[model samples]
Every structure is written in structure tokens, then in C-alpha cells.
Target: LSPADHLVVVRPNYATNIETPKAIGCAISYVDLDFDQGFAIDIEHVKAELRPNTKLISVTCPHNPTGTMMTRADLDALIALAEHHKCRLLVDETYRDLSYGERLPAAASLSPSAISVCSLSKAFGIPGIRIGWLLTRDPQLQETFLAAKEQIGICGSVIDEAIARATLERRDAFLASLLPEMARRRDIVQAWIDGETLVDWVRPQGGVVGFPRLNIDAGFDLDRFYTRLLEEHGAYVGPGHWFEMPKRFFRLGFGWPTEAELRGGLAAISAALRS
Candidate 1:
């Protein structure tokens, strides 16, 4: 395979912390998505990035940090593009169940060209249970992925898998109870942001995270701001610079912390902003 074999990476991606050329790397041509546009993947841009040497195309739904989703039509277009180019499309649907509306169809379910990866992290709130899996119709690719795992071995604890399986068995019930609490926490954070004059963001459509930008025109230096917030207020918010955007943006986790703690953190952040 040529070193130039292009791998199209769609972002603001789930799991990716930033948005610059180096943030993604040269092996993969990064396709930028607009945060203001609900983080939709631009199909035309994706098409333009395709080369005969392109090997893989990857995407995330209920995207991390931004919490945006890929619509069904966009996904359909991606599948078509992959088939047309004879490339593989890797879809990370880790947060798929957390979406706001009818879930988009799994790309792997639609075609052999699509590969879907999922984990028990994020929405399941079980990072400790490091079990994740991929689904693909191609036996050869599946064998390849499994072979790669042998090199990595099964570092995931069996205990973790057992617990994760139980959680999966009760997934619907668990999410039904969890979603309300998460939604409430999200609302609290949104309200706090709305009241604050120093920050703003496009509201996330799904998932536990949101990326909000500090009022940069007001001379906000997010790196320093986050450092002071952590050191002085004992609060943590992910800096946007970590995700390759303007330093004004910071990632805020709404589902990870308890509502009370999230509120307190937001209050601390507001105080820091004022300072």
C-alpha cells in the first residue's frame, strides 16, 4: 500500500480532542465540519477528498466534544462514496443510542463496505469496562482486526466484560433512567451558559459533552482561564485548543459529573469568567 493511500477522517470527531491539520495527521486527510451547522459532515467535501488510493473513511455519530450527529442522508452518501471508491468506511457509533431522535441506520448494516465500531464507554458511563467491538460483513477484514487485537492482546479485564455484558442486557432500562438525569444536567449547564456573558456554544444534539467558546473578542485566553479555574476553583473544563479550534472553546462534560457537582463547577467557571 502506498504511504499516500489516503484515509479520509471526518471530524469534529468523537474521541478526537482538536481541529487542525496536525491534530489529525497527514496520513489522513481531515474533513472539517462546521460546528455552527450542527456538526453535519459535508458529503460533497468528503467526495472531493476521495482519491483512488483512499483506503478508509471514518466518522463518529453523537460526536464527542461537539455532540453532533450524522444524518441518515449523509450516511447514505458516505456508503455510496465508499462503494464507488472501493474503500472502507469505519463508523464509530459509540454514542449512537444517545441521539435526540430516531437513530440513523448503522452503516455496517447497510453495506459490506461499512465497518461499525462501538464501545461500552461514553453513554454507558463505563470507561473502566474497556470493552469495544467492531461489526463488518467482510470476514477477511474481521480477521485482520482480530489479528491486530492479538498483538494488543485482550488487555480488557474479563470482569469488565462481564459487567459490561450485564449492562448491555439492561441497556434500555439503564438508559431510560439515565437519560432524564443527563437531560436535566444538560439543561442546567445550558442555562448557566445563557446567563453568562462570557461564553456561548451551539447546543449539543446528543451525547454528554458540549464545546463552548469563551467570548474571545472580550480577550479571553482559554488556556490561562482553564488553568486558573482548575487551580483556584478546583474545577475542570476541557480547553478548546486541545480540539484544534480557537483557544476560546472549552469542552464541558454534562453527563460525567453529578448534577450538583456540574452546577457547582459551572458556577465556578462563571466566577472565573467574571474574574
Candidate 2:
């Protein structure tokens, strides 16, 4: 749809998702998922925010930087709502494959109105290939998306395609080894956050990272605190402002570093706060 139509965006969401849409001049409205409810996005909020001219409703399942998973019931209701409203429901399922243990049903599979976008980068640890795909049952949207892809990249590399194919062929075996380790890392980070007095968070149900609320007061320049944490303390993290969140809320990427490195980094963060 054109930029003239209204779009509803999720707050504290991935920057590109929010900015790219706004950059193109789409009229924007926001629905913030609260941290206290484990970052749950209430359906009533969506109902209240829906407009007669609304063209798109965008959301992420197994949310980025927060690791919150939208319940199946909520997802189904959203699909039905989009159907009733005759608007597109775009669900970014990049992290769906990395769910703690259970398999998740793709939104597109349940409804023709659903648009599902996914990539192997975060889920399978294969970003170098840069392979991603979009799925939709709407022929017109599918045609439009293909046209957009053509304008951007005429095609992809054969070698990368072959590598991706090989990776997927062994997907089960690979994920078998990877998921448990991720769960371990997630737990470690959770335990560490639990012990910290300066921060509180809604632990992730699935996915690799989480957004933790820093206890800094309102009107404080979280940007300055984040800068010092990086420059003077030799610690780096995703500052909340980057996600269009308050300065006191920062993203904690708990799954990437090794156990020892994770512990060390957490200690460094703790030390920085103490100072």
C-alpha cells in the first residue's frame, strides 16, 4: 500500500521496522507492549487504535531485543482482526525458529491476510549468506513484493543459495545442538539480572536478547549514561533510545557471548553502574 494510508507500529520495536515505514511518509500510530506484562501487546490496544484508513498492522513474534513471544490466541485474533478490517498483518517471524523448544505455526499458514517475513541470520546463525524470504497468499501483494525485490537486488548468489540449502537440509541436527545452548545462555542472563538491584526485566520466553529497565530517574540523559558505560567502562550495549524507548531502558543481548564472557560483561556493566 502507498504511504498515504495509516500504519500502526509497535513501540520499542526494531529501529528499521519503525523508521523505514515513517521515512517513506506513512502516517504512523503506535501500540506499546508493556514491560511488566512480559512485553505483551494487548489486542484491545489494537482495537482502540484501528482506523478506517488503516492499511497495515505490523508486529514481531518472539520480539527482537526483548525475546517476548506473542501467544497463539493473540496471533489468531490479530489475523481475524486484519481479515475483518481488510488490512495487511505483517508478522516478522525471524526468531520463530529459535523458540525455546516448541514449534510455532507460521502466521501466513493460518490466514491469507497474514504476511510473514523471515531470515536465517538470527535463527540459524547464517547472516553472511543474507538469505531472507517473504510469504503471503495475496497474489497482488506477492507480485508487488517481488517487484520491490527486483528493483533492489536483481537476484542472489548461487553459491550462497547452495550453502543455505545445505544448512536447511541439516537444520534439525543443527538446531538440536544450538537450542539447548541458547536456553542455557538465556537462563544465565536471567539469573544474573535477578540478582541485580539496579535493573528489572521481563525474562524472554523465547529468542536471544531482552530489554531491561534501568532504574535511572526520569529526565536523566540515558544517552550520556550509555556513552560512559561504553567509553569509560569499556562495556557496550544497545541503548534504549536507538529503539525509540526511554533512555533508562536498554537492550541486553544475552545469547551471543560465551558463558565466561557473558559473566565478565555483566560484571563490567554492574561495575559501571556502581561507579
Candidate 3:
């Protein structure tokens, strides 16, 4: 999109979603998903934010940090809005293969005006390969996107392409081996949250991450909790500041760490809270 274009995006989104648009000098409107509402996207809120020049509406499924998934009806409404407004709808599906329930259809498949982007980075744990793709059914738009991609890098790396291909070839087997373990880890986190009054979460439906907030009043020493979590226990989390939220919220990942390490980290959170 051109510098003069307007973009509507979700707040507390993946950093690149906001950052890249800002870099392009696109005017942006943010539709914030609220904690009180379980971080679900309000379609009317999104529709209200659209401007005459809005070129794109950006969102994610199994969203980053919060790990909330959109219902199929909501997804359809978003696509319909984009179609009505003559703007592209960009759906980031990096974690699509990791769904804890029914997976929504790739948005691009349902609309010529929608774009779907996916990568092996999240679900396959292969960011080093640095491979991802964008999809659109519109021929003219596809050509424009291809021209822009060619200007940027000419083509993808041969080795990375080969590796990505091989990985996709066995994607089902990989997911089968991983999903059961992820479910167990997810259960462990749920049980911990159930037992703790110091913090609470919206309960992630999918993906490896969940954003939980500390249940503290004004007198709580929030800094001390973070300090003890790190220096005292060597545990780290994606701070809310990383997503432009208040420091009470943090992104906790349950997919990468071993079961022992995950339990240890959860325990550290408890100890740090008490300290």
C-alpha cells in the first residue's frame, strides 16, 4: 500500500503488524481487544474504525500474546466488511496449524479481497528458515504483490525453500506428535492458574502463549515481582510492554520448554508473587 493509505489494525498485536505499517507511513486506527471481554474482536468496533481511504484491516487467528481464536461467523463478518469497503483484509495465520479446536478457513480462500499470511516459524518452530507466504485470489493484486516482493529480495533462499517444502510434506505427522504434548502443557498451565489468586488469565484456546495479568491493588510492588522472577529464579516472560499494554500483563509460552522447566517456571511465578 502507498504512504497515503489508511490501515485499521488490532491493538496489542504482533509488533510487526503495527511496526511495518508505521514504517510505510500508513495512517492507522487501532481496534483494541479488551481484557474484560476475553480479548475477543468486536466486528462492529472494527467496522466503526474504517475510514474512506482504509486499504487494509489486519488481524490474526489464534492471536499473538492472548492466544484467542475467532469464531467462523466473526471471520465471515470481517471478510464481508472488507468486501463492502473495498479494502483488503490481512489475516495472519502463523499459528493456524496449532489450533486447539476447529480451524477457521484461510481468509483468502473465501474472498478475493482478503489476504492470508502463514509461516513455519510458530507452529513448526523453524524461524531460522525464515520462510513465509502471502495469498490472494485477486489476479491484479497478486501481480502487484509479486512486483513488490521481487523488488525487495528477488526470490527466496533455495535451501530454506527446500527445508520448508520437506517440513510441509510431513506437516501432519509433526503436528500429531506435538499436539498431545501441547495439550498436556496447556492443562498444566490451566491448573496452575486455577490454583493462583495472585494472577488470572482469559484461558488461551489455541497457540503456545497466554497473556495473564497480576491481580494486584495499588500497594503491590510490581517491580519487585519482576525482579524476583528474573534474578531470583532465572525465569523470563514476554512483558506486556512488548505489546504496548500495562506491565501487569505478560505473555507466557508453554510449548517450547520441557515439562520440568515449565513447572519450575510456573513455580517461580508463585514464589516471586509471594516475595
Candidate closest to the true structure, highest TM-score? 3
Worst 10 residues of 1 by lDDT: 17-26
What's the lDDT for residue 11 in model 1? 64
lDDT of 3 by residue, 1-275 (tens): 77999999987788888998899999999998899999999999999999999999999998998989999999999999999999999999999999988988999999998999999999999999999999999999889889989999988899999999999999999999888888789899999999999889988888899999989888887777888899999899887889999888999999999999999999999998887
lDDT (Cα, 0-100) at 260 in candidate 2: 86
What are the lDDT scores of the predictions, listed in order?
Answer: 0.80, 0.84, 0.92
Residue 118 CA error for candidate 3 (Å)?
A: 0.4
Tell me each candidate's TM-score.
0.90, 0.95, 0.97
Candidate 2 lDDT tens digits, 1-275: 56888888877676777778878887888998887777898898987888988888999988987888888899998998899999989899988888985656998988889999998888887899999899898888889999999999999999999999999899899888988999999888878888998888888877788888887667666666677778887778887778877667788886678788888878887777766
Candidate 3 stretches greater than 4 Å from native: none
**1 or 2, which is superior by lDDT?**
2
Q: In order, how many clashes per candidate?
A: 5, 0, 0
RMSD of 1: 2.8
Clash pairs, candidate 3, are none
TM-score of model 2 relative to the true fold? 0.95
Query: What lDDT would candidate 2 get against the real structure?
Result: 0.84
